[model samples]
Target: MTLTLTQTAAEAVKQIVARVPQAEDGGVRIRDTGAPSGFELSVAPDPEPQDTIVVTDGARVFLDEVAAASLEDRILDAELAQDGSVRFALGSQV
Candidate 1:
């Protein structure tokens, strides 16, 4: 299984990637951080060799091996605030 994203999440990622310097190949990246949620989100200029890449509406998401396995059955959603902050949520795939 692979990861998936809601349209809002995809757009948020696209906007983030667009603002980064020298990030033509960049996208949002997710990794397991051993925290309670075990997830860490960030932007990467490129995917690592072992990443799972998911693209939607031209937006890209890079998932590390651990995160890929964990999120494979989930969907990503996002909310963008007027202050330019983004909140991401994960839900079980319907």
Candidate 2:
């Protein structure tokens, strides 16, 4: 029901928000794919060419049709890598 954003994650999201004109929502939605293996994010199917994870600064973090059911508890955390890379942690909604 509630999700927490790590400082790095928040900064990343904020940076993304600054770039995109549509991401005025100011939050990211994380969704789970119904697949037995993993999850994806979005309100629609994954795009072609590359199946890489897609993230945006949109106010809403959409859950792909398949991802919605896989994830229940939602917590967004970030880790500042030694190289300054940001890592995100996704967990149950509990």
Question: lDDT tens digits, residues 1-94, model 2?
Answer: 3344445566665554455555454334444544564553322222332222334332234444444444434566667666655566776544
The prediction achieving the highest lDDT against the true structure is: 1
- Model 1, runs deviating above 4 Å: none
lDDT of 1 by residue, 1-94 (tens): 6878899999999988888888867998899996896688888999999999999999999999989998988999999999988899989987
Tell me the TM-score of model 1: 0.93
Residue 92 lDDT (model 2): 58
Every candidate's lDDT: 0.90, 0.47
Question: Residue-pair clashes per candidate, as listed?
Answer: 0, 11
- How many steric overlaps does candidate 1 have? 0
Candidate 1 local lDDT, residue 72 = 82
